[model samples]
Structure formats: structure tokens, C-alpha cells
Target: MSQKRNIFEEVGEQKASTPTPQGGMIDQGRGGARRGIRAWLMVLFAMVVVMVVVGGLTRLTDSGLSITEWRPVTGAIPPLSEADWQAEFDKYKQIDQWAIDNQWMELADFKEIYWWEWGHRQIGRVIGLVWALGFFGFLLARQIPTGWTGRLLFIGGLGGLQGAVGWWMVASGVTSGEGVTTVASYRLATHLGLAFLILGYIAWFIMLLSRPERDLMQARRQKEAKLWGLSTGLLHLAGVQILLGALVAGIDAGRSFTDWPLMMGQFFPPEAFSISPLWKNFFENPGLVQFIHRMVGYLLFAFAIVVFLRGRKSAHGATRAAFAAAFIALSAQVVLGIYTVVTAAPWNVAIVHQVFAILVFTLILRARFLSGYPIVTSIRGA
Candidate 1:
């Protein structure tokens, strides 16, 4: 017997649509369950990309401390006229940093750097506005998923706190005297640390939303001993290494002595621990910091190769791709660092090296996630 169509079924045909990850006519696929959050997270992550690039520019131009002011409300506007510029310069002059170090630098010269700092702040303000509008709209639109709104709110709050942290970093340099030209090394590291934190959260959210589950290759997941533990450890190790790299950059450790494998001379420089009490030098002495950073690089490369070989034997698409990407990125970063060293940290190569480090960092994360840890035997639905 044939089934009969009901009146509601007939009317429903005209209005019904396949539901999205959210209850909408959005992407309708097996993995589309969390797409709305993913799309918005992508938007937030894009802004973070903007933040990182501009932050790099701020470092390059040495404009990080030019403004000497941090009024969230009034500071949103730029110094337009000559009087305005002079007033800004005058305020900067009062700081010990200007009186001692950059005192000879002209007001016109100061303005050049000022533009970079101004642009950084202005862009941040714009990002804030965009985030506010997006966040509030999402809540009103009922487009946001259940628990993710709180998570996104936390991310937003962290971003807002970043602005104040930035000022705190800037303050440390000037506190010493009027002539201070650079931020304290530790403060610089903290600033960069938060950026890394933001990037990690963004990447994590993206991964969770975009591809919550994937089929594991039995051949790949089974073949392991220390490779799994070793690779994961190395991933974390690389993160710690990056933090040391930041310390190196902040303190101008490159100039300490740039002959790899030997700081100034000898397999291990005699003065590596010259900072007094061996442990102290690891964090303070430029020579030791650079040496430790290089050592970490060597260990990370060795670990990567081990993972590459193990994954190569398996036929998993994601695993193979991740291994290949990580290996290549790490190799490129190493080469870039070598160039940066030989050239004594020229801004161009150094900056590229830093950016590549971030890329490799992400690749390392991808490899670890695809490594098929605790749930290796779990089957994914097609």
C-alpha cells in the first residue's frame, strides 16, 4: 500500500530546510554541527592575526614606547595638527626615557615613530568595536551555541586585558630613567606570551568546531612506543623554546656572540655560567640563553625526524600531511634562524624567522592532535 501525505507535510515542504550545525540553513554536513561558532571564531582569529602582524611592526619600528600616554577614551583620536604633535612630543620629553636616551631625537623624528604606535592603538580600538558589535549581536540573534558564548566571552575579556598589559610592559622601560629606550626583557616576554596564549586559544577553538572527530588509521595509531610521548613532549618543548627565543630577542642576546655550537669560542663557552650561581644565568645571561635556545632547536629537530619516519610508514592522510608540514616548517625556521644569526639579527630575517616559528608551532599542534592519543581506537561515523 502507498503511504498518504498529510496537509502539514504538504505545507512543511514549502518552508522546511535542512538544519545547519546550528538550527539554520547553513552548512549541512556531518561535521557541520559546530559551524556557526567556528565561523565567528575564525573572524576573531583573523583579528588576532592582525594583532600579531601589527605587533611585529611595532617591534620593528621601535615605536612601542613613543606615546608615553595611555588614555583609553581620549587617546582614541590622533595628534592631527602641529600643536597637537608638539604637545605629544612635550609629554614624551618629560619622561626619563626621552631626557636621557632619545633626547637628541627631534620632534619631527619622534613623530615618525609616533605614527606606528598611533596606528597600533587605533587599530586596537577598531578591533574592540568590531568585537563588541559581533558579540552583542550574536547574543541577540540566538545564533551562538549553548556553552560557547561563555568561552568566547572569556576570550574577549582576555583580549581587553591585553591592552592594559601592553601599557604595563611599556611602563617598565621608562621607570628606570628618562633615557630608557627599551622595555624590560621580562615584561617584553610577558607581552609576547599573551599573544601566544591568544593564538593557541583561537586555534584550539577552530579545531574543536571544524573537525570534532576523524577516523583513525589503525596502522598509524598502533605503531608507537616513545614516539607518541616523545613527540608530544617535544611539542611542549618547542613552546618553551619559543619563550626563550622571546627572551633572547628582548635582551638583544644575538649580539652576545653569534657563533653557533660555540658562544664565543670552545664547545661550551667558559663564561656560560658567568652570571653567578649557575641557574641564574639560564634566565639572565645572554650567552647562556642563546646557547640553551640553540640546544632546544637541535633536540626539537631530532624529535621531529623520529615522528616523520614513524608517520611515513603509515597511510593516514592527516598524519602524513601534518608530519610533512611540521617537518618542512621546522626546517625552514631553522634555516631562517641561521641566517638571522649570521647577519646578527637583521630585522628582515629575524622577523621572518619569528613568524615561521609561529607557523611551526601550529604545525606541531596539528601533528600532536592527529597522533591519536587516548581515543585512538574510537571509530568515527561516516
Candidate 2:
């Protein structure tokens, strides 16, 4: 009984002698707020994809220059009255697209092309709105992670720059006389390239956020160096193929040849070097441009085969599976390219071809990521 009276006092004295724990607050590793931000970025990514597809369609239908002016704010609202519609049509008549290619287009016919262009631009505006709202909301709430603020802001800036580039691309055709009814091929390529760049950046950010920082750091030690490097090369080669596709579409090169595994009944088109001023053949010459595109596609497929074989030997099951999936996509894309050439690039088939290109591009990125941070799996086998 006498010892019990002093026991509680002795324990308290012992605890007070130990040192206090250091550090103010523990890092939770980008838990809740970062997850929310990732979801928001995903939404933005989807919108950008739609924007690219619509942009492609606009070009496909020769509807890109329907709107002659680039009124960023005022253009959001389409014509509201009969008089307004006429005024819009009046502006279109001033361009060579109307004077040459669409001279027979009445007001009703004009509306079809007009709406396509309008919808494409409208999507751009909405994307900007989404980025601004999400960025500021995260900023105010302190939701963005420490190193991510700059990355996000860079995306928003790119979005803004994309708008200006869109206008610049549009202006190229608007200023051209009746001789040129479409935007400059190089400008179109620039616009398309920037769109993909933004898409890729957002995709990378999403992947980075998928794992905790400490885990990624630890995984870096076991990264498959050769596979990672090969996948990176594949990524860049796919990018070049995409830009070439844009050039093909720009000059309607895809529609110039309807033969597969050969062009104009030859492995190479007979007139591949026909364009004068030499360099213009790469951009403006339909035969040469399509030939380059087809040759590059073959080379890309061959390199992808090499990369896939290496990827199959990776220790991680998921890494092997990702490369398998990428190979599948590459095979499908090659088949689609043949069909596109055989059919002369019909809108239905051509759009599918374009979409599959995007899919292949993304799968390469996925495979690249898996090579760097492989998913480990346990097996019960000897």
C-alpha cells in the first residue's frame, strides 16, 4: 500500500527525462489534396484530347477557316440573329475559301462548315476556363503540392500560347489569296505539334502524381536502364511520325496515293522529288510527303519490334505486359495506315487512323513509365 502511493509519481518522472520527438508535422506524401488535383487535371486532359480530334476533323472537312476573325472573348457567342448570320457569312466571302473552293455554298451550306470551326474554337475556350478555374481553386485552397505549382502554371501558360498559335495558324490562310485555300502546312504542323506537346506534358504530370515521391525514388534504383532508353527513343520516333502525318494531312497527301506497301505502283512514288525549290517537297509536295510518311512508319515499326523484344525480358510482369500492349497498338496502327492509304484517306477511316496514332503515342509513354517504375509481382513457382 505504501509503494502504490508513490508508483504514479515515479512513472511521470521517468517519462519527463526522455527527449521530445523532433519535426513539427509529418509529411503525408501528397495524399488527399494532390489526388483531387490529379482528378482535375484528368478532366482537362480529356478536353484537350477532344480539342485535338475536333481540330483534325475541322481540317479534314476544309472547315478550319470558316471564321475569319479571332475574337477570343467576343467570339465565344456565335451569331444570334439573321443579320448576325449574314454578317458572318459576309466575312467568309472575303476569303479565298469562298471565292474558289466554296463559291457555290449558300448561307445554309456555309453554316455547316461554320459550326465545325465554331465548335472547335469553343472547345479551346472551355479548356482555358477549366485550367484557370482549377489552378486558382487549388492555389487558394493550398491544395497543390510543393513542386507541382510551377508545372501546373506552365500548362496554363501553354494553353494560352496555344490559343495565340491557333489564331496565327488561321491567319495564314485568311491572308492568302485564292491560290491558297488552306492554312500553311508548316503552321498547321506547328499548331498540331503544340497540342500534342501540351497533351504529353499533362499526361506526364498525371503519371508522376500516380505514385508517392518516396516510392518513386526507391523504384528509380531498380529501373530497367536499356528498356527505358529504348522506350524513350520510341516516344520520339512516334512524335516524328505524328508530325509527318500532320504534313500529309496538310497537303492532302494521304489522298494522293491509294496503294499500300507501295506508292503509285512502286516502292517509292515515281515523282517523289518532283517539287521544285527542293525543301518544299517535304511539306508541299503530296507525293514526296506521303512517301516520307510511309517510309518513316515502316522504320518506326521495325524499331518498336526491337524495343518490345527487350521489354519482354524485363523482370517485372507488369513491365512485360505494358510493352506487349504497346506492341499490339503499334501493329494495329500499321494496319490502319495501310487501309488509309488503300482507301485514299476517307474521313471515317482517316479519323480512326488519327485516333489510333494518339493511342499508340500514349501507350509508348505508358511503357516508358513502367520501365522506370516497374510493378513487382510475386509468383508461386520454382
lDDT per residue (tens digit) for residues 1-382 in model 2: 3334564476446445678875423245354477888899899989999999999899988999999999999999999998999999999999887888888999998899999999999999999999999999998988888788899999999999999999999998995465778999988988989988998889888988887776677778889999999999999999999999999999899888887777778887887777788898889989889888988999999999999999999999888999999999999999999988888898989899988988888889989998998766668631
Best by lDDT: 2
Q: Residue 1 CA error for candidate 1 (Å)? A: 14
Q: Show pairs that collide, candidate 2.
A: none
The TM-score values for the models, in the order shown, are: 0.81, 0.92
In model 1, which regions exceed 4 Å deviation?
A: 1-36, 176-179, 212-231, 273-280, 313-315, 372-382
* The candidate that achieves the highest TM-score relative to the unseen native structure: 2
Off by over 4 Å in 2: 1-32, 176-178, 379-382
Cα distance off (Å), candidate 1, residue 68: 1.2
Q: What's the lDDT for residue 216 in model 1?
A: 27
